[model samples]
Target chain A: AQSVTQPDIHITVSEGASLELRCNYSYGATPYLFWYVQSPGQGLQLLLKYFSGDTLVQGIKGFEAEFKRSQSSFNLRKPSVHWSDAAEYFCARIDSGYSTLTFGKGTMLLVSP
Target chain B: DVKVTQSSRYLVKRTGEKVFLECVQDMDHENMFWYRQDPGLGLRLIYFSYDVKMKEKGDIPEGYSVSREKKERFSLILESASTNQTSMYLCASSGGQAYSNQPQHFGDGTRLSIL
Candidate 1:
């Protein structure tokens, strides 16, 4: 079975500091990878996605994710974190022959000033 | 912008009561899905519909059912609500194409509680 794993349950970073959230997947080939953010009481917002080419993909809100086939990882990163960036981040993938996305357990980000 | 709308943002129900959760999409998407979100479970797919009157069982489909009577509307039914059924239900929609990837659009979600 295909699955997504987010090792870090929670991460805290200072404002203006760099942030990286790790994600690993259990699959044979590189499936469609995605990063989504969910604010308190809000639905998920797509940050970035990786399909076929370009290992490094840029997304909205200054977010970027690198899809590493060799590592079986699609990690999300941001250069400078703002206080408003505190939210839950989820890594998702659409495995082969699946129409729905399989999501990770999610990483809760806490921005400290 | 693609918009997926759930009928409720919060709901409270009693045990063994039948419950209905409605979802509507304005993007004219060909695919619709229902997922339940738990604190540590992330999101688990409950059901999916590719077209009207067509449904597919997802990862967790027990104690639940679905209805897709219209192209823009999909409903998830809890035949007998239980205390363990309390969860945040999410509705999503996406365009369908063979071998093509389309990102799903999500609604705000409905937080359902069974007592």
Candidate 2:
């Protein structure tokens, strides 16, 4: 079975500070990984995804994620945090044969000045 | 840009009422999915359709049913709405088999409140 685990339930960062949200997965193969963000009362928006290739993947809104094979982790990172970046982030992987996604509980990013 | 539209932004219904939440995608994608969002649970898939008239169960499909009579539209039904069923429902679409790599595009979501 494939599952995602985001250890951090919430994280607070100051503006211009670097941010990192950890996501570790349990999978046998190279599963498709994705990062999605959801604002309060809003829908989720795709940040980035890694199917294969370079471990470091760039996404919209200055967000990037690095997939580490040995670590079994795909942690989302942003070099410079902004107030508008505060939202719930979900890490998901497409592992099941049906191409369905298994998501983590999510990490709430709270940006503080 | 791919567009996914949900029929309502907010809804309120009484328990035992049969509720329908509609979603339509104009991108002509072959895969459509419905999910319910709850705090701390992330997103749980309810049902998904690969093509018209074809459906498959997702992670959480016990209290939900689906209809896909047309290619561009999918509907989620709550057989007997319960307070526990109240949640933020999301609809997503992606290109079929050959294009399965495409990311799923989502709608604004419908926040349903059951009384």
Candidate 3:
């Protein structure tokens, strides 16, 4: 079974600092990776996705993720963190089949001023 | 923009009561999915429909059933609401097959509280 792992349970970064959210996947074949963000009391929103392309994938709100095959990781990054960027993040992976995705436990990002 | 709407933003029901959560999408997407969001569980898929009248079980379908009588509406039913079923329920839709991998658009979600 394909699985996604997000190592961090919680991360606190000061405003204006750079941010990186790590995601790892366990799969035998090609994998479709995605990052989603959820604000409190709201549904999950897609931040970015990596299907097949240049390893570096850009997403909304000044975020980008790089797919590294050697490391078995797809890490999300932002050059600078804003207070509004604080939210819970989830990493997901899907292999060609039923189209259902498996999600990680999620990492909570807390931005402080 | 894809428009996915849920029947309620928040619901409170007594335990053992039957609960129905409705979701509607205006995009006419062939694929509709229902997921439950818990504190640490992230989003667990409950059920999904690929086409009208077609349904499939997801990772966590034990307490739920689904209905897709119309192309735009998909409903999730809880045979008997339990306290453990109290969580945020999300609905998402995306095109099927040729557009299978498209990012799913989501609704605001319904927060259910089973007493």
lDDT of 2: 0.92
* Candidate 3: residue A43 lDDT (0-100): 81
Identify the runs in model 3 with alpha carbons over 4 angstroms from their true place.
none
The digit string of per-residue lDDT tens for model 3 on A1-113 reads: 77899999999999999999999998648788899999988888899999997999999999999999999999999999999999999998877664787889999999999
lDDT of 1: 0.93
> lDDT of each model, Cα atoms only?
0.93, 0.92, 0.91
Q: Considering DockQ, which of the candidate structures 2 and 3 is the better prediction for this target?
A: 3
TM-score of each model, paired residue for residue = 0.97, 0.97, 0.97
lDDT of 2 at A28: 60
Q: After superposition, how far is residue A65 of candidate 2 from its true place, in Å?
A: 0.7
Descending-lDDT candidate ranking? 1, 2, 3
**Candidate 3, position B43, lDDT:** 85
Which parts of model 2 are misplaced by more than 4 Å? none
Indicate the residue-level lDDT of A8 in model 1. Answer: 99
Q: What TM-score, to 2 decimals, does candidate 3 have?
A: 0.97
Error of 3 at B62 (Å): 1.5
Candidate topping DockQ: 1
